[model samples]
Target chain A: MRKSTAPIISIADVKNVLGKQVVHEHLNLDIMKGEITAIVGGSGCGKTTLLRNILMLLRPKSGSIKIFDIDILHCDIKTSQKIRHSWGVLFQHGALFSALTVLENVQFPLRTFTTLPPKVQKEIALLKITMSGLPLEAAFKYPSELSGGMLKRAALARAIVMDPELLFLDEPTSGLDPQSAGAFDELLLDLKEGLGLTVVMVTHDLSSLAHVSDKVVFLGEKKVLAALPLQELLKQKHPLIQAYFSGSRGESYVKSA
Target chain B: MNNQQPAQLSFDKNTHTLHCSGSWTVSAISDFLKQPPLTTNKTNRIQIEGGGISRMDTTGAWALHQQANALKKSGKTISFSGFSEEHTALFQMVEAALPEKQPRPKSSRKPSFLYVLGKKSVDRYFSLLNGLAFLGEVIVFFGRIIMRPARLQYKSFLNVIDETGYRAIAIVGLLSFLIGIVLAYQSGQQLKTYGANIYIISLIGIAMLQEFGPLITAIIVAGRTSSAFTAQIGTMQLNEEIDALRTMGVSPVIRLVIPKILGLIISLPLLIILADICGVLGGMLVADKMLNISYYSFLLNFPNMIQLQTLLNGLIKGPFFACIIAGVGCYQGFQVVSSADSVGRKTTKSVVQSIFLIIVADALFSIILPWQSV
Candidate 1:
């Protein structure tokens, strides 16, 4: 892939440890603007850990993480909070505030970060809810009342309610059916073009990586093994990369791609 | 300066048209809506020109929808021009998905006196019935163990004893000792006025042996053991661990509740015995120091003061209060709903209910056992 003039996110020399066990060491990566990047790895390979580190929820033992050129690891609380407004995160479980209705969940960040009138805030929240393909009536229902698909959509609505420049999705399609996952992928692409968002997603779905990801970062053996476009990465002669792409799940999608 | 103009809504009196321009995202809309530029009620035929609008999102769509609704409400006909296909689609999508207005039921400020009384009485009646049913199930669980001693979970019973009974000894011993000291100190002062100071020994011995020692130990266990049991089982229920046990054909009542019940039954009396010793020792020490009563004199009267019946009275109440605490805690655990908050609420309810029922049971035992005649 051609290099962009500047990357939206930059990580270098990152080290992560949980007690005595090292999860990641000397990991380096850059994510460009308006591109969807997927981080894929074997089970327990710390994909989620890296995502948490970049989101500033977890601090690595040693590393520098820059988001939109701001040093995230060393920032003051006020600066970090201000920078957080430009990004959105969709957790694996939806993680909607259980006590709030769907509309209230979507409106939470808007209420916290903006001084907009309540009427306008509600209207905007409703609009985001619709854009995420949820019915208007769902706005009144609590998170527990929603089905799995509706919960993901409601979570998506909340993530994008602020029109964030960067969006992080953790296993967005893991539990979804094929049809819904396809629709979700199409929605991501549409949002990318329409709103010009930069997306970083942790996904195990090979078909999603083949179809939606501009670049795939493969983590293994306590470090990043490779970062390349799906096609090029599949073509690599590395033994681990070869074994991964030759697997039954990857074989089916690789043939189709 | 001109290029940085956020967004504006201006009307031309000649053409009856409203033109909006600049960024119309959330931040810009907030500024523009502070003092809205046009009133749609003033015109019947209005044209909205969006040619100058630069950046728009769902928030902008919502803004336009709000404007359209305001215009339509006042019987004004409006038209949009120069909006892109994407913009039009986004605006129309939000417009179509607006929540339908529903008439809310009016809530009265004060409920009628009869309503409050009826609701509360019904709630209390059902809760009482529920409690009796839970107690019956616990008794049935013990009956099963009696019939098939091999079915008893000996390992888990020991585990619960280690957690709730053994771990709780320190606090129980400390609190009962302090109670003994306070009782002797306060009563000794008043007894001296009547030249009855030596009676402080008898008073301390009888009270600690028959009431305060066991009562204090049970109360501490109620707060410690019962709350932990409730929180543990409630969290298991939340995570479907209890459901998993059921799916494997293991009855939760037999596997979970029985062990806890048996543990508390055995541990409560044993812990009470220990607490009684600590309480008697505390009173003797206080007497030796405070009232100039020597330890030898205190010990000489101690055995006479503490009759075998008095110790038996306190010990008999042990397993009963243990049953109440363990039973209430586990019952409240099963009562937990599917939420993190429900676990907390049920734990608190378990502790309060256990302590309350323990005191009530103690009162009933005292009344029925003929404490005064003895």
Candidate 2:
């Protein structure tokens, strides 16, 4: 692979917890600037941990993580918070604030990070809420009042409220219906191109990987066993890789595509 | 992990032999103390054989000495047949601090259920009762608010008014009207027996304004609004919103609990006053129609029957009961574990516990207040 323009996120020989005993040893990976990358893995594989490490939510026992060339571990709290604000994370559950209305949830990051007037904040919040394809009527309704797909859109609205440069979404479409999941994929693709975001997503949904991912990294057997495009990944000879693509797991991908 | 298993021990009371083996630590001593006494008979002699003891520390020796002393005090003889040199040294150290055992009084009576359950559980129940003892806590919580005059969060205050005060009006109004009708019906029968049916106004006016009106209204609010507060916060906790607030630098107590507490504190008295007025009006309509009493005569005696103390007493319990309801609600909410069922369980517990405490507090207040002098 042509060494992509100076990598935005670089993990050097990272070691992390595997389970009760085993650890992921000496894993090195780099994500380039302004591109969408997908980390795919089977159960017990450490893809989520790697994303967590990159997000600085988890500290590696013995390795360095640099985001935009700044060493995150050694940075002070204020500097770390500044780095965190530049990234948006969509947790697997959507993690929308249940007590807050959809508009309030979307406005949370803005209210915390900016000193903009309330009117401007509301305008910005409504814009993002609308951009996520939710109805204007949803602005006043709480998360408990929303359906599963609407909840995801509300979460996406909150995630983009800060206009984060890096977007990390963990299983964004896992629980949604097929139509909604495909719509969400298109929305991600649109954001990736329009906003020039460096997106790192961990997903079991292969259909999404094929549809939008610029690069795919397969984590298994305690390392990044393969890093290739979704199309090429299907042809790989690794038994685990072949099993994943040939089984019920890959059926959703083929059917959706 | 290899050393984590506990060594076994058994005592044959019929044979008067105590068998033991273990590396006994303080934790092991505590575990031993948790068991029932070895012998039931006060005069039974006991023998402890420590030959199988692999490792004995000071704590183990201390435990042994205590057991021996307890046995001796119960009018029984205790003999230690085998002891390692280390164990002997520890025994000597423990023996030096302990007082000489004396003959214990024999009891012919059997132990009660409470005794069998042990002091620890008794203490736990007492503590739970103490937590449910809301009169003092209610007084203190309200006293602080009224005396200190802390700068209230106007926005949250208004939010609570919207949630507790306005939302509760319909229910309180409906219930009060029904209670009035019941009161009138019950009193009308008794009053008609004496040909003094006009006195129903005095009965309803005095009773509703003095005691039942405020107490019933406060209890209803505690059941309806306070439990809702707990369930809402408990659900938020289960959903991680409380954690999110903490991570974002918002104090959940001040932002959430204080508002609800203050809102109830402000609204409950007003609700009681409203219930009292509505209840009196309902009573008047029933007495005038059902009892054939003139509305003019009922009104004439109503004012004379109800002193200023009646209204004052009702108003007094409002803030106190409000504090009780709010505090219990928030306490239960904060205690919720990360489960959906915990929300419902805690909400129900908050209402039940709050009402129970409110009544008990009222009883205590009635006994202590100078009502006779007034």
Candidate 3:
């Protein structure tokens, strides 16, 4: 995504403290509208923590997070909830509610966030399930019964059920076979085009970074090192960043890009 | 943008044309599908004019595609005009993503009621045999450990003792004291009628040592330790930690199950001993208050009335009860399927099954042993 003057999501001077350790200090980031942005970093670099902060699941020690230009840090509960409805999140390992069937899991957000009748919610959920590349029979199966790939698809269906403008995906292609991962990238790109979603994904899959992400954000040194297009990120001078994009997988990804 | 103008459809009879107008999105789908001006017969050779459409999305596209499919089913020619490039692409994408019909396998034949009954009975029988097989495996594992004492997980055994033993002391003591007081008071009332108030010591001592102490302690442990064991192992199973352990060449039975079994087996007898002492002390207190029997006289008569044989009978039942509780707890843990709800159900089942088995074992012991001989 291009760096637009008006950002759909903005983070400024973010400070995140975990016990005596500091995860992020004076971190600033922006996500443009209708762009697929991938956050990549090494272990212990707090990529997941940043995603959690943006999702409002974790509160930063100090920061200003604005979604749709509204300051979320100081916003009242009702206002914050209203803003939350404009975005959807998919967690790593699909974090699906194991107690609910695929249909119920997809319908969960609509039930909580909308006053729509059950029948309409069901219809929308079924449509989203099909869109997420799941079969009709998968609707009734429990999360426990689903394979890893199917779980991710079911979770994705739930995430997009409300047609939120911003979609947050955490390690979306992790644990999937290469074919399934490639198929998942295609699905992400398809959703971005067809639904005009501004997607923020945290992933380490270089191929996904190459194919799906319009822009890539590299994190190191307790903060974002760079936020640039995938091609530009590859040419970065930072040793860690260079090493990250120099692996065999990275070479394949660059060739594909 | 006008509300009346939105979703308005006009069919020209002369041209056989359908004019679509307004917001043809998710919100307008109900109205568009429920009230279409084009009749089923008139839809033949249908021409959809999309120029009047103010907005359309994937949902709208899907709805229109479904309508087109219906028209095709009726042998009608359909065409869309004035749809923007974006809308056209989205429509085609959604149409391509539609789920394909799959053929479900049919059951060859419905089983007769007798067959179902026989099948259920066979399943139940196999499950019983499976439980026996599990017991055999546990016994074999125990024998192997006995032959090689160095293989025991001492740290895990100690941890289980801390959890199921030391932590359980307070509740076991409290319940045993209360049971003793109830027993002493109730028996003392009837014995007073016969001027045999001193016999209250014998009643409470014999009952506590031979029956209530071990039985009550086992039941409490079943509710406490059994449920904990099931939930802990069941959650580990759900998280694939067991699979991880297996891949690392760790025997779950030796590393996980045996330690728990050893902990409960060692702790239960010690708990029963504490319970017996507390119970006897409680009876003495109640005997002094309710029966006007002095504590001095109660202590003097207690050993004479409660024989070593009587105390030994209850203590002997401890390890058996422990085995049942621990075995049932771990067995139910293994039975847990994937999901958080299964953990809760298996925990409940563990407690229920352990207590049931303990009671059954105690009953058999009582029937075979001579309690009346004391």
Candidate 4:
């Protein structure tokens, strides 16, 4: 998590455009190995778009994204598999396969990528399922059958089932009630400490941003305005950052800190 | 340092311990579990040595835990020694995260075959009753709209008619015309063999106007527009759009279903008339080409050969077939459960059920209708 450590992911001078509208220009960011870095921004600031760029769901119009020292934007599908094997992604909508049960969803990557026997695979998947705070009985349930909080937990279990060193989360706690959201933040910290994972998440929840992230990347003006710890970034004099954290709902957390 | 030394495991048989060195990480697990540690019968306790380990992931730690569990099951006590604090914590975490054995209340006895048969038959009967209940709901909604007049959805009515009506014209006409040509050619050949080629006019007219035109048009609509209705409403149901309408104080049955029923009723009879015209033209073309019947002679004999009642009987089936098609499609759409898989299944059921009902209705008309005098 230290600044001196080599970055697990680095983006240099990226430009992202969608249909003549520029989302991000000259965007540069770094995610150090073994840190929880969060991308937080206003509604249309393209936080999810930036996450997609790194995940290679959408490649930026220009610039480079490197994860585990591999230049992902220019890599072939075969080369990308190496990065894919080392990291797991949780989509905003809990994009768990609707057709598969939660246990089968967790076991999918291990069955496809690892040569471990099936019995061991089930053991590891169950471990992750319990670790993510889902009851084991819920494992056989379909995605549609799960509540919003349960859906996120199920997706988290599947994401970490492979024990990847790098994890990317897009709005991991967006739709849940406050109690569940706090529980999810605690779960995130636990996973980060337990697995020694380097996490990069896109979220707007101020409480989670203040509590969980080792570093916060504030996106604004189509670029990263500040990539600092939450307290340090909050002290900046910029009108946009000031207005963002000054809102009635988000203010108490800042004042409480 | 992510890639450290390859893992090493050694059994110190004299000390009753397993010595592990180098990186015990995820990549090494598949091979690591293959070589289980060896212990002699004299040893009552097993110790796993982890001091010399260079790296470890949760996977490596979990796999090692499984090995330790296996040793414990074999009447040997298991313990870990010389692990770095981080590695020890990770090992403990993996140990703590293991799923608890839960006692779910599962049904102990399987149902008998006779029970299953009885249940299936009851389910089928309920589904039939459900269909009639759906029809009752539609008729109630239809009556309400008729009484209120202002409650009718003109926009959706126009949209539905445009979709299942104007858009369907080309395919219906093409198929009807092709049937007409085949009917004319086959029957005219027989009439020519008997030197009664002019009778081909009566044969082609009766078949196209009295039976084939409405049946063919209905079958095509069953396959095309009916399936579309099912998929459209099924997807809406999946998206909770129907729920959204309900929360807004809108009646989903009136807003979604009734307009389709009305639109199809009005559009189908018009389409049946168009089908009849296309069929007659195709018959005339084939008659002139194959049997040497001139257009002028065909036109002169057409009214005498086929009466207006023949066309009217076929058109009468149009509204009935349309009602069945729309009713079945919308009903199946409402049956779509939460999953996307259900949408596909319901759409298939919609088409099959529509065609089946259409054919049954057609058979009734064939048997009991006063077509013989006409």
Error of 1 at B277 (Å): 3.0
Alpha-carbon runs more than 4 Å astray in model 2: A1-4, A249-257, B1-374
Candidates in descending DockQ order? 4, 3, 1, 2
Model 3 Cα lDDT, one tens digit per residue, A1-257: 22356788999999999999999999999998889989998988999999989888899999899988888888899878877877778988898898998999999987886555566567667778888888888888899999999999999998887777789999999988899898889988877776677999999988888888888999999889999999998888999898887788777778778
Model 1 Cα shift for residue A82 (angstroms): 1.5
Per-residue error (Å), model 3, residue B337: 3.0
Clashing pairs in 4: none
Best by TM-score: 4
Compute the lDDT of residue A99 as modeled in candidate 1: 78
Clashes of 4: 0
Estimate, for each residue in B195-244, the C-alpha lDDT of model 2 and write its tens digit.
98767876887678867788789888888877888888898897789999
Q: Which residue pairs come into collision in candidate 1?
A: none
What would the per-residue lDDT of candidate 4 be over residues B1-374, giving only the tens digit for each residue?
24567677787888988888877776666776666655558788878989988778777888777778777878998788998877887888888877767424346589999999999999999998998999898999999999997888999999989998899999999999999998898888888899898888888888888899999999999999889999999999988999999999998899999999999999988888888889988999988998889989999999887888788888889999999999999999999987878898999999999999999999998887787524
Place model 1 in a CAPRI quality band. Answer: acceptable
List ranges where model 1 is wrong by over 4 Å: A1-5, A245-247, B1-7, B12-23, B34-37, B40-55, B72-137, B146-155, B370-374
The DockQ-based CAPRI class assigned to model 4 is medium
Q: Which ten residues in a row have the lowest lDDT in candidate 3 chain A?
A: A113-122
Q: Each prediction's TM-score against the native?
A: 0.88, 0.46, 0.89, 0.91
Per-candidate interface DockQ score? 0.33, 0.01, 0.39, 0.51
Write one digit per residue (lDDT tens) for candidate 1, span A105-135: 9999999987898877887787778778788
- TM-score, structure 3 vs. true: 0.89
The CA lDDT of each predicted structure is 0.85, 0.75, 0.84, 0.86
State residue B86's C-alpha deviation in candidate 4, in Å. 3.2
Question: Model 4 chain B — which ten-residue stretch has the worst lDDT?
Answer: B99-108
